[model samples]
Target: MKAWQATPPFGFDALRLIDLPRPTPGPRQVLIKVQAAALNYRDLEMATGTYQGQPQQAFTLLSDGAGQVVEVGAAVTRFSPGERVIGCFWQGWEAGRLSDSAALPLGGPLDGMLSEYVLLDERGVVPCPAHLSMEEAATLPCAALTAWQALVVEGQLKAGDWVLLQGTGGVSLFAFQFALLHGARVIVSSSQDDRLKRLAKLGATGLINYRSTAIWHEQVMAITDGYGVDHVLEVGGPRSFTQSLQSLHPSGQVNVIGYLGGHQGEINPLLILQRNARVRGISVGPRQSFESMNHAIEASGLRPMIDSMHDWLKLPGALAHLQSGRHFGKVVLRITAD
Candidate 1:
């Protein structure tokens, strides 16, 4: 088998696709023939030496992948050969609140799925929605699940509520789709006018190009009839946190999943108190939530938006593309020929 590993002195140039021995699964594990994987902004961070807590050892480098089970262990009853599945981001978190201690997340602290074949405990994977392909399924484990956790699970989003999205990244796009799924209205912001137009076509209720209007939160309030959005997918970290609070509908939830805006800026607690804000930092999600979201996806027939697809072997260039901030949706890697 072959795996992409980021050895010490980590950077894109340090990535090496190396050969490794394939191992049989343990008694409760399953072996999957990985078909596709998706690159997150975090993956780009890992490549550019910008991500925090960089791994010290070489490990398979992706937290999101989808494939078919080719073999199973003696006691692995949850899955069997030929069943399509996606790995969970938090392998040990099945449901409920997270404890102080949990299993290492994939791609950094643990071996990820950017390999020809990967082994996982039966509990660490979920069935791919029947309506999605391997590439689409690969985009879900992190970005999609994170949006579901923040919007539906935590915010308790309902019809007619308003949502504020930060950008055209995978998570924002998924949140857009899910908000539409629940009959909610969405207001999205971006620096690119062309991308905002594209989002408009995808049913964005209000659009703001932050480049033109720095005070975008006022637009959010104005769009919602001087009230504000019910939820804000705060992807801008500290730089946008203050505005996210301002754009809330008194007691609105702000799900902070920021990484793009480099973590430095002043956030006043007075804004939180004024808005009665409910801010929660999202950590992707657990396996049970993944399963529930899969059911909704399968039933709603919601397809993930892919900005581009690359061959798995061409990961360096793919990561570079993602780093360039040009992609409007998920950038997927086809690991094997379909």
Candidate 2:
């Protein structure tokens, strides 16, 4: 098996491709021949040694992947050889509330799926939606599931509700799609007008060019007719948290999912108290949530919007693309031919 590993003192230049013996599955485990993988901002953090609890040794590079099952352990019954499956971001989190054991996520403390072959507990994988291709399914584990958890599971989004998405990244775009799937209207903000135009075509009822409108929450309030949005996907962390709180209607929720902007800033607790707002931090999600999301994707025929695809060996280039922040949607790595 071949995999990309980040050498100690992590950076893009530290990534190396090496050969190793293919891993065998243990009881209740499954072996996957990876067909595709996707990159996330966290991958960049891991590569640069900036992620919290950085690994002490080398590990595989990406958390999101889709592959075909080539073998299953004797005790495994949920999946079989030839089944298409996607690895969950938090392999140990099957359902219920998160625990200390569930904190070890893929692509960091644990070896991930950026290889030709990988092994996982049957509980760590979910069947991919029938309507999506391997590349699209590969995008679901992290970005898509985060959006699902933030909007559907946490926000309890409903028809005609207003959702404010911070930008047109993978998570935001997926949130936009899921909001529409639930018959909700979305307001998406981006620095680029072209991206905002594209978002509008994808069911964004309102758009804001944050580059021009520094205090974009005012735009959000105006779009909502002064009532404010029902939910805010707060991906910008400290840089946008204050406005995210201000843009909400009474009792609205803000699901903190990312820190794309700088992580340092001040937030006022008075805003939360005044609006009676609920601010929740979202990890990607449990496998159970991934399964429910798959059902929704299949039922609605929803497909992920892929920004671009690169060959498996082009992992470095893909990472660079993600780091550049110009991509409109998920940046994928085609690990194997379909």
Candidate 3:
């Protein structure tokens, strides 16, 4: 088997493709022939040794992957050979609230699916939505599930409600699709006017080029008739938190999911207090949530927007593409034949 590992002195340059003995499943585990994997901002953070907490000395490098189950342990009953499945971001988190064990994430502390074959506990995988290809399914475990947790499970989004998406990255784009799927209107902001136009074509109710309008929240307020949006997918972390709060309606919720813009900034508590805001920090999601989102995706026939696909050997190039910030949606690495 072939895998990409983050070697010592963590950075993209340290990523190495190496051969290893194929892993075998133990009790209640499954061995999947990984077909595709997707990139996330966290992947970059981990590669660069910037992810919070002690970075792993060595580990595989991707949390989102999809493939076919090629073998299952004797006790494994949840899956069978040939079933298309996506690995969960948090291997130990099955249904409810998280625990210490849930902190053992893929692509960091544990070996991930950036390999030809990967082993997982039966509980850590979910059947892929029938409507999506392996590349599309690979986008769900992290980015799409984070969006689902923010907009659906945590935000409690509903028809006619308004949503504010910070950018056109995987999570934000998934939020846009899920918001529209629920019949809600979306306001999307990006630095590029052309990208905003593309989002407009995808049913975004309002678009703001943050590069042109520094105070994009003002435009969001104007679009909502001064009422503000009902939910904000706050992916920009400290750099955009104040503006996100400013763009929310009274009692609106802000689901903090990423730190693409920067990690440090000052925020006034008064801003949150004034709106009686509900601020929730979102992890990707648990396995149960993934299953629920998969069902919704299947029912709605919602296909993930894939910005580009790279062959597995082009992992470095794919990582560079993700770092370039030019991709409008998920950037995938096709690992093997589906």
The number of the candidate with the highest lDDT is: 2
Candidate 1 lDDT, 143-209, residue by residue in tens: 9999999999888999999999998888999999999999999998899999999889989999999
- Candidate 2: which stretches are off by over 4 Å? 100-103
Please provide, for model 2 over 10-55, each residue's C-alpha lDDT reduced to its tens digit, 9 standing for 90 to 100.
7988989999898889999999999999999899888888987789
Report how far residue 102 has shifted in candidate 1, in Å. Answer: 1.8
Better of 1 and 3 by TM-score: 1
lDDT of each model, Cα atoms only? Answer: 0.90, 0.91, 0.90
Q: Candidate 3: minimum summed lDDT over ten consecutive residues — where?
A: 95-104
Candidate number that wins on lDDT, 1 or 2: 2
TM-score to native of every candidate shown: 0.98, 0.98, 0.97
Query: Which 10 residues in a row give candidate 1 its minimum summed lDDT?
Result: 97-106
Error of 3 at 37 (Å): 0.7
Residue pairs with clashing backbones, model 3: none
Sort all candidates by lDDT, best to worst: 2, 3, 1
